[model samples]
Target: MIKVGIVGGTGYTGVELLRLLAQHPEANVDVITSRSEAGQAVADMYPNLRGHYDLRFTEPDADRLAACDVVFFATPHGVAHSLAGEILDKGGRVIDLSADFRIRDPELWAKWYGQPHGAPELLKEAVYGLPEVNREKIKQARLIAAPGCYPTAVQLATIPLLEAGLVSADDIIADCKSGVSGAGRGASVGSLLCESSESMMAYAVAGHRHLPEIQQGLEEAAQSDVGLTFVPHLTPMIRGIHATVYTQLLDDAEVDLQTLFEKRYANEPFVDVMPAGSHPATRSVKGVNMCRISIHRPQNGKRVVVLSVIDNLVKGASGQAIQNMNLMFGLPEATGLNQVALMP
Candidate 1:
């Protein structure tokens, strides 16, 4: 079995990791760390994991973490960098679900994150972990920087258009909405039930941290700089992200948008290309590592609309992290990620 350790196992992504790892045939949870919740039974805090995991939370210790074959950093952005180098030095691979190593430019990362990067030198070595785009690279990487929730949904929806040169890359617009869980497990007035429920509003319109990450991925796919207007909204739900993407078609030719999406994701195990004229709903992908997409060209106009949906906590975070781990360990890409989406 591949021994696994998780740092910061108290947040939404952290528990989601535990929920998935509990059933992984080749994975064993060796340690779970939390600064504030150390010494508490993981099941005590998360009753859903009671029968699956009998482990207790511990403080983040490099030595103990390095002993495992791989470590997953589910902590906030800055926490992973401080401990990743030591784990790597001790011959352990790392999968970080934070923004610490996602962006290539350390200066840009520092500017958005509001602090100096803890390990700028390691940025060059950390591979961006989006299985659909970087599957081969992930198999050989020792450090994997998983994509953020918003970027995961937006990029999957629009990358094919950019790659095929079917759309104008300069005028791409991604209007995305996410559940309150995207804010994290922390308490805030903005995330309160009274504040979010029955009310929908956009935040981070001026600039969201995920904007640069999304642009970076799209630009790489298009082989040129892309101009994207990414705006994120907070919905009343608890989990999922719905991204409505708009792009202008370069030619008025009769192009099969459905075929384009289906062919692109034909071999991908996680991306679901829905039927033509279908609108994918966020709940359809909840609690699973799946990105369901639907493509449309209204009134046969030059504009194309792509709707993408994913569980913000699963496909958007922990589930994708485990997918990268499976690739890194030479296991089947779907080894532990084959769970069907949970239904009501």
Candidate 2:
């Protein structure tokens, strides 16, 4: 079995990793680290994991963590890159659920994240961890930088169009909405129940950080630079993301919805394109790693709209991290991630 270690085990994504990895048959989660909750039973903090994990949270040690076959960093930005070098040198593969390594350009990363990158040289070494697009790269990658919640939903929705040259790269727009937990487990003024519940409003209108990351992914797929307008709104729900992508269609470009998507994602495990004219709801993907997508023709067939949804913590972060881990270890991509969506 592959021994796994998780750093920052007290956050939302960390708990999610535990929930999913508990069912990963080929892996053993040997260590979990938390600075503030060290020595406290992990189950005490989250009762959902009580019977599965027997250990308590502990402080992180570079050498001890390096001993595991793989390590997942579920911490916020600026924490993973600091210790990635030591872990890699020790032969430990890493999957980071932070924004630290997703953007290829260090200057753009610094500009968006508001801090200089700690490991600039290692930037090129970390593979972008969207399994559908980069599965082969993930198999050989020692470092996988998982995509952000919004970017994951947005990019997966539009990438097929961009790759086939069906849409103009310069006129893409993503109007996305996410639940409150995407902000993380920290106590914040904006995320307070009084402020968030019973309300829906848009924030980060013109300059959200995920903007650059989305552009980077699209450009990579299109083999050309892409400019997009991304706007994210906060909804009162606790999980899930719904992204509506609008773009102008290229002249003489046409695709049969089911046939084109099926051909493109034939070998992919997680992305599902709905039947023609069918709309996908966020509830259809809750508690699963599935990205349910659908397409539409509007504006007298001059433009196309793609609707996509996924559980922010699942396909967007922790679940995708585990998917990358399976790839790195030569295990089935859907080993511990095949459960049907939990519906009410």
Candidate 3:
């Protein structure tokens, strides 16, 4: 069995990783590190995993983590880079679910994250871990950087159009919204039940950190610099992300939305391309690593509307991380991730 270690195993993504890994037959979660919750049973902190994992959380120790074959960094942005070098030096594979190595341009990363990169030399080596787009690269990568939740949903929804040369690269606009759980499992005045419930407001309108990451993916797919205007909003729900994307058609020819989408994601296991005019709800993908998307063509203009939905904590975070791990370990991509959406 492939030994696995998780750094920062108390947050939403970390807990979700534990949930998925517990059922992963080929993998063994040998260590879980948490600064504050060290020495506490993981089940004690998260009652949901009481019977599944009786392991106790430990403090971050590079020497201890180097023993594992693969280590997952579910910590904040700069935290992974601080410790990744030692792990990589020990010939251990790493999958970071943070922004530390996602953006290739170190200057851009510094601009958005508001500090210089901790390890600039390693920036060129980290592979962006979006299986749909970079599966081949992920197979050979020693360090895999998982994509952000918003970028994951938005890119899957619009990339096929950009790659097909069917949409104007400069005219694309993404007005995406995510549930409160995307904010993480932390206590905050803004994330309180009453504060977020019955309220809808847009934040990070001018510049979201995910903007550059999304642009990087689209630019690579289109083989050109793609300009995108991204705006993120917060909803009252507990999970999922819905991205409503608009783009102008490049040519006047008749386009079959369903045919195009179906053909694009035909071999992809987790991406579902719905029939034309079918609206997909968040409940359809909750607790699963599925991205449900549909499209529409308006008569007024050559404008195409696409709706994409995914569970921010699942497809957008931990589940996708596990998907990358599966690829890295030469296991079936769906080996430990064939979970159906948990519906109410």
Candidate 4:
């Protein structure tokens, strides 16, 4: 069994990890840490995990964490950097669900995250954990940095066009909306039911942190510096991300956009490229590790619109983390991730 330890097990991603790992045949939840909730039963805090996890939340201890075969950091951005190296040195692989090691450039990370990276040296080695884009690297990675929720939806929608060189990279735009759960389980005025319900508003229009991560992935696909305008909105729902991506086709490029997307994700188990003209709903992917996409070109015009949706906490965070762990351990990529999305 792959002994696993999780840090910050009180958050949404953490519990989501617990929920998924509980059903994983080869995974064992050896330890879970939450500084504030130390000594509390994991189930007490999150009733959904009551029967699945029999462990209690422990304090974040590096030595204890290092003892596991793999450790997942489901904490905030800076938390992973502090202990990932120690775990790696102790022969434990790490999968971080934070922005700490996703961006390669330390300066860019600092600019957006507002602090010097805790482990700049590891930046070079930590593989970006988007399995569709970096599967081979993730399989061999000792440290993995999972992409953010917004970036996951945006990149899945845009990468195929960029890779085929059928779309203009200079003017890409992603107008994305995510549920309140993306803000984390913390108490915030913005996430309050009264504040978010019955309303929709866009924040970070000037600049959102995920912008750089999205650009990084797209630029890699395009193999050039990409000019992208990314805007994120907070929807009133609790668990999904809908990204409406817009890009102009290269002049006179008469490519079959639907076929291109289908072929790009043909073998990817988690990415579902819907039939032509299908409009994928966020709920279709809720609670599952799936990204459903639809392609369109209004009036057969030069501009193309792609709709992408995913359950933010699943594909966007915890479920993807587990997918990376499966790769790192040589397990089937969909081992414990085959659960269907929850439906109304």
Q: Of the candidates shown, which would achieve the greatest lDDT relative to the real structure?
A: 1
Q: Is candidate 2 or candidate 4 better by lDDT?
A: 4
Residue 273, candidate 1: how far off, in angstroms? 0.4
Which lDDT tens digits does candidate 1 get at residues 1-344?
99999999999999999999998999999999999998999999999998998899999999999999999999888988879999999999999999999999999999999999999989989999999999999999999999999999999999999888888889999999999999999999999999999999999999999999999999999999899999999999999999999999986546788999999999999999999999999989988999999999999899999999999998899999999999998999898888877777
**Model 1 residue-pair collision total:** 0
**How does each model score on TM-score?**
0.99, 0.98, 0.98, 0.99
Scored by lDDT, model 4 comes in at 0.93
For model 3, residues 58-98, the per-residue Cα lDDT tens digits are 99889889899899999988999879999999888899999
Q: What's the C-alpha lDDT at position 196 in model 1?
A: 99
Backbone collision tally, model 4: 0
Q: Tell me the spans in candidate 1 whose CA falls farther than 4 Å from its real position.
A: 252-254
Q: Which stretches of candidate 2 lie over 4 Å from their true place?
A: none
TM-score of 4: 0.99
Candidate 3's C-alpha runs over 4 A off are 252-254
lDDT by residue (154-270, candidate 4, tens digit) is 999999999988999999999999999999999999998899999999999999999999999999999999999998999999999999999999887988888999999999999
What is the lDDT, from 0 to 100, of the residue 306 in candidate 2? 88
